[model samples]
Target: MPAALLKYALSRKYPARHAFTRRRDLKKRYDVVIIGAGGHGVAIAYYLSKYHGIKDIAILDKGYVGGGNTARNTAVIRSNYLTEEGVRFYRESVEMFQGLSNELGFNIMFENRGQLTLAHSDAAIRSFRWRAEVNQHMGVRSELVDRKTIAELVPNLNLSEDSRFPILAGLWHADGGTARHDAVAWGYASGACERGAELHQCTEVTGIETKCGRIAAVNTNRGRIECGIAVQAVAGMSSIVADMAGIRLPIHSFPLQAMVTQPYKPLLGPLVSSPHVHVYIQQTSRGEFVIGGGSDPYALYNTRSTLEMKETLSAAILELFPFLGQARVLRQWAGITDMTPDYSPIMGESPVEHYYLDAGWGTWGFKATPISGKTMAELIATGRTPDIIKPFELERFYRFQQINEAGATAASH
Candidate 1:
């Protein structure tokens, strides 16, 4: 199938019911006004109402709810990181995601299938060992597996001596998994709306009106929204939105591409990846094999897919699993990711008063929707940044207190 047709089919099979369909008169003064109705934005709205007792909230988006990165993500969730803070924070995120379906009273299809990241070189093995040790210390279910173990784990993978980027070992993360992307947004939207939060779609914010360095109102296509607090959870346009608030975030935009193969029997059991090859593959419950790699070497804001990425990623896929060479691809799509310097998101406060941030998600932000929303909610409602998210503040760049997860996030996220 073509990418659009396949996407339309998949979306129809799992349609989003909680889209922002109700048009309401803009409240003159909302306690909070969140921009970008993605997963992060909806999750924030839900947490604000449920946890913080703040009910008067408005979530504004330029497009439909959950139609941004929330719908475009590959949906991998895990916490087997190499850093203590990274492992700790993402471990919490994993736990939240594990029970997210039940918690949201909706079926998000959170799957805790194990993930295996292959190590093709001695250097890769060393990095895996370090990551496994750190993850274990942080109470994550990650371990180093040898070549024999790799053969048992994924019998069809090419581990022969003559293979390129030969599989020497793997970092097995038993806690890594995936979820239904749209369901997360719906759950949050439904729960938040039930708690009295208003959602407005087809609303474009053209300017951020401020006075005395404090947010006064937001000028939008619909009208000016008078608000007390504002958050930008718009994934691809994080920097653009932040710029509107006169904040210079250290975030860069890059396009990540992923594709699905025609349905086949469950040949791959766990999510498999390679840092050397910069590729990851896993079969979905519906039987399609999802394939993705890192971003193109160049930075781009485009969401258009390319034949070059498809050829390169397919080559890597065949290199790992040559048996699937005949299987045709069903679709290919691209999403713009907001990446920060550390490969970790910059959440919490900005320099501007009453302006908060939940930006810089990159390729890994979709899995972090619940956690980011919870943390940002706490910050906005309580007026204090949680310790878990304090290290990822926007001022970290200037303060030289960075949380670099590039090495660990590369293969796994």
Candidate 2:
């Protein structure tokens, strides 16, 4: 080790460097005002400043950066979706995630460990087959695998035929992986701030003022600031924020719970999920296993973890990896997800002119952070929606053209 490194490592107190700038004053005007300072919001600002040369941006968050759903998600990145639109969109996101660390000049700790979705019944087998075909047609590395291949891929998985839900087949997605959730948000915020975009933490958006059917200014707890464009990227609070703009969105908020086990010997590889049991499991690089499942059965805005969810997740994970029964759980938490009827995100133009929407991400928001940011930046900068994201516009709900992905998003989130 270098002498300076040794000295720093041995120091009693280490210096801390702030990734994003701290601004106390809000500007009177900006080219764009983005609500929510999570991964999507910061990524949008980063792309706007770096790609389109639009640096007059303001990112306002009610709390600290990346403190919402961005910090709460499990960080699974995959492209093996069912619908054509969903598959294509997430495929690009997977590709972007591969190079995100280098592009942002930050270590996001991205690992392409692949993902395995287990099938326990004939219906699940058929669904996996369909999704595999759709994914393959879109150039994503996804295929249906038999029990033999699954055993080779995940030697530790329970393959007992006498189990309640026998392992019939699986969907092996080689393009799937995971990354550090908060690091991604921090990287984008740092990059965007370096390029002159301002981030205001603890700045709450109170309401929005419009003039002639266009956005005029945004009212915050701090003060009101005029902007040419306003974009809402608040994940769980999408409907509430859109309501402030006098626009109603078709969204329902639900709490998704997850838990982490105490660090143990690394015994799991590849992300494992089973929709039949409604649970997913992945061991983090730190040796702690993350376990999560579908959203709560009811719709609510609170982020409270429940004992029932913990018991359900624990039981489901044991069904797939029986050896983990000895592992001790360290903590559990929850996040609010803004779900749409179709289980697909609503992007692009909204009913309010000059007020773009980036809402209804549900459980798949973190995986699409980069692509959503890039495409939304393009739309905001050029005043034209990109072709890649037009299919996800809010108009789809009005036209009854929902890109249904309920089957694809079941417990895989």
Best by TM-score: 2
Tens-digit lDDT track for model 1 on 102-182? 888989998888889988889888998999999998899999999899899889999987987778889999998988899
Query: What clash count does candidate 1 reach?
Result: 0
lDDT of 2 by residue, 1-413 (tens): 99999899778687555578777699999999999999999999999999999999999999999999999999999999999999999999999999999999999999999999999889989999999999989999999999999999999999999999999999999998999999999999999999999999999999999999999999999999999999999999999999999999989999999999999887888999998999999999999999999999999889988999999999999999998899999999999999999999999998789999999999999999999999999999999999889999999987899999999998897
Candidate 2 residue pairs that clash: none
Error of 1 at 266 (Å): 2.1
What does candidate 2 score in Cα RMSD to the true structure? Answer: 2.6
Our tally of clashes for model 2 stands at 0
